[model samples]
Target: MSTDVAIIGLGIHPFGRTPDRTGLQQCAIAVSDALKEANVAWNAVDFAFGGSTDAGNADTLVSELGLTGIPFMNVANGCATGGSALAAACNTIRSGAGKLGLVCGFDKHARGAFKVNPKEWGLGNWYGEEGFALTTQFFAMKIQRYMHDYGITEVALARVAEKAFRNGALNPNAWRKTPISIDEILTSQMVNDPLRKYMFCSPSEGAVALLVCPASDAEKYTKTPIFVASCLMRTRRFGTLEVFSPSKAIEDQKTVTQDASKVAYEEAGIGPGDIDVAQIQDTESGAEIMHMAENGLCEDGEQEHMLARGETDLNGRLPINTDGGCIANGEPIGASGLRQVHELCLQLRGTAGNRQVKASPKTGYAQVYGAPGVSGVTILNS
Candidate 1:
């Protein structure tokens, strides 16, 4: 017997700038909608897991949403929190510890400057620098390096931004739906060297929730259910330092992303060619290009070629980020991973509407990464 977990229902509370609702309120809205969509009551959830960062305590948020008397846990893996929560829920159900599980993710934009806990990095008040200082700057450096090494042009990056914005225009819930021209993208104020504002992900507030249950209970809830074929997550070992760093001489080293993708493909009994659709975490345009190569969608240094050929567009051979991705949809921090899964579920169910691909998508993949080198990949099949 195949021990496959099923997603009976999914809910997303938009993806954009919202100043009125708190993170807790967004969580409640998503969770309630998920339960109603699955035709299951709150008490039916055998386990609950909330994914967030510094938004608030998961336990308290669950309590505020009236999720009590249940085994609940909080997951904080930076940007990958939502995907981590789903993986945990899948493991619990696969272990037969729970028949039904609920995973909720939400976040509110930081009121002022975004800061990190000093203890996490073993730094004290000396690390009072603004949050974007390190994170965005680090990624900007990577983008510059990638461009130089691969000879990728700015036009290639503009293509990525344009594609995402076009997709976002079709998604009512997306944060920035207005389509931008390549000239506009190139002229946008540069956030970092070689990375314009259009390449950066916008901060937004939203929530997302998912209901996972045993395959047996799938029919009881929704007739058109998606199966969790596999969930894979891996962290970068000291070995990856060589693969990603130009100074290292380790020629055989593999990136943390490729390592995680290998495990996920093996567990799903499929290869990259079998993926019908994908929702990759592209906080920046460069990320999407690099991930395409790292995830085996194309050969190393060939991402720009693929993009120029229109292979990564909505009507392309293997459509990616059909729901606009973090680039165009806005990154709601905690809810991003689940939002990716939600888009995949919608596509697999053939309910994506105007943004749907031409081919019949039977399998979908979602990937998200966070700082501290955390990563998550989930495979869903219809």
Candidate 2:
């Protein structure tokens, strides 16, 4: 028998700009919503895992939810944090170590951008400052190099933003619902060179929770439970500094997204052509296009052409970021990965409402990647 795990229930706090709640409070609300959706009592859960970065204490978030006597752990992997937590929960269920596990991810950007602790290197001018500086500057460098090497135009980036905003208009939970034109994105203020203010993700507060269980218990809860076909996680073994080197060889090897997708496709017994729907980490518009090519959805450098031809729209061959992705939905740090999963779950269950794709989505993939080259890919099947 296959030791497959299934998602019994899933819940998501509205993805928008909300300042009233802290990250912990957002997590508690999501957890309660998921339990109610799953028809499972909070006390009956066997384990709980919280994913976050700057959300105060991880354990405190669970405690605030009135959770006790369950093995609780925290997960932090930059943007891939929530995906990592969900993967761990699936592993536990597959191992028969737990009957029901709750994976919760939340983030409140009201506290401001999460900065890296400079004290970790112990003073006196390290090679680089940690935290938000590295994240913003590192991706900035990559974007510059990509534009230079590929001869990509500014119009390409604008098209990416336009596509995401168009999709976001249909997502009631998205932060930016108004559709933007290519001209508007091009004229937007530049945050990092070549990356405009409209290109980067907006910070917001939100939470997402999932109830995972063994395949045996799926029917007890949900009529439309989605199976966890595969879960894959990878880290940059050579470190981010290598990519910054002035060597052609090193630059060619800086394809972590492609590598992770290869592993996930093998484990799931499928390929990119088999995927009916997908949610990719689009912290910036460039990332959305780059990931599509890197994940084999199209040939390398073909994403721009795909977008120009309207092949990635909601009614196109392969609908991407149907929930507006991190671009329109806002990146809530730890809650991002789970939000992607939640969107995929909704697609598979036919509950996506107005934002639903017309394709018969039998399988879907959700990928979350971070600045340090950490990535997680979860494949779900209906």
Best by the TM-score measure: 1
Candidate 2 off by > 4 Å: 1-3, 110-114, 118-132, 239-251
lDDT of 2 by residue, 1-382 (tens): 1338999888778877667777888788888889999998888898977777667656676567665678988888778989899888988987889999999888876533445443442332343432234355555667677677666677888887888898889888788899999999999998778889888787777889999999888999989899998886887654233222322344346467777889889888889999999999888887777778778888756776777787888888898999889989888888999999999999999889888999768898999997557788999998
- Best lDDT among the predictions, by candidate number: 1
> RMSD per prediction, one decimal?
2.7, 2.7
- At residue 10, candidate 1 shows an lDDT of 86
Off by over 4 Å in 1: 1-3, 111-114, 117-119, 123-133, 241-252
Worst lDDT run of 10 residues, candidate 1, spans 240-249
Tens-place lDDT digits, model 1, residues 109-157: 7632245554574455444443432456556776788889888888888
Clashes of each: 0, 1
- TM-score of predicted model 1? 0.93
